[model samples]
Target: MGDLERELRDLSTWLETPEPPDVRAQVRERLHRPARRWRPLAAAALAAVLVAVLPPTRAAVADVVSGLLRFAGVSIAVSPEQTTPSGVASPLPGQRVAGLDEAQRAVRFPIRLPAKLGPPERVLVADPDPTGACRVATLLYDGGALRVDAFDGRLNLSFHKEVIPPGAEWVEVNGDFAVWVDGPHVLSYVDRAGTVHKESARLAASTLIWQDADVSYRLEGARTQAEAIEIARSLR
Candidate 1:
């Protein structure tokens, strides 16, 4: 057995021993001889002895001691390094394309298009996910290099657990508030099951997120905030 386990076992064994007759008599005598300045110290010692001797009390004390020791030097880092998942960052997988009409039939929300960007090169629809139990549709422009993701809910993610990067700016998009995070920030999302999705962690494009009514949108691949705002304004 390991040293710690062996020591615990030995302590348990020693605590199980019955007090000798003389020891019991001495304990009784000490209890009777009270009211002195050392009486509080003696009572505390007696309580400790009781805790060590009783099986239930000893087990409880051991649990508390072990827990405190285990957490002594452990520190949880909440910085950028801790936000991204451990595995090699991978690209979003299995993204397929469909026509705008087909995508509209598949998703639960209305799709908005940017007049400036014109018709998208590809329309990608995401299956209903557990996080929001709603479908997400993506409009890919510029040969699928630029994307606008439209869904039916809010992106309520905590900055501590998700990658919001170092600089997050709040701005207005078509009279609605939006958050712009510069890339390549770790692209992570929490699903309905509260699980983290980091498949797009290594993407280099900037992102702009905004909401209107029940619909939310995320525009990616803009070179600057002004360009993103202009594109967002074009969304109808």
Candidate 2:
């Protein structure tokens, strides 16, 4: 059979199967029922559409993660990006990796550290991002990296954000909807300034993210799903 036919058959099979009970609960709880049951399915279809449109060599999948909380108008999309020909994962342009004290001074919002994780061993700060909002900070622990992104400019500015290659399962964390993307995929997003960014597409870990106030916190590079959730719960 042709590849397209095989893909269609697989999609049909998935559509017929029901989502796991636990995942259903998480989606219902976090999205607050604001989204219909077909939203995720639609997202899956969108990915399929992209696959059909893009070249066969560029075929990839992404998950659209949106619901009750908009994360201050930040649209969360888990998609992949193009990579280098040499297979080298280069640092994002206009990004700097610095010490904790140095990173703290760069961003407008206060950096948060998980009680269980303590201070991060490394800190990455992004200033003058495409968004031109406030600075973005990423705290790197041994097991994973915690990202803190904020917008101090006007509210309701819509921007597209992407993370990992689309297998996100919703889970309740601290009574809030949090997403855990399985496997390592490239994470990309559009900054407030309407610029698209492609982070490293070579990440080899899972990620967990939730919102706190106006800041959207993302924890990446976890060794396991349970470890990621445990660390996320420790955020204060």
For lDDT, the strongest prediction is 1
Per-candidate RMSD vs. true structure? 20.0, 11.6
TM-score per model over all chains = 0.56, 0.55
Q: Candidate 1: TM-score?
A: 0.56
Which of the numbered candidates is closest to the native, going by highest TM-score?
Answer: 1
lDDT of 2 by residue, 115-203 (tens): 87887777777645445423567777653454433333233323333444334555656765566667654444455565645443344
Give candidate 1 regions above 4 Å deviation.
1-95, 129-134, 154-165
Question: What's the lDDT for all of these models?
Answer: 0.54, 0.51
Candidate 2 Cα outliers beyond 4 Å, as residue runs: 1-88, 129-134, 143-166, 199-204
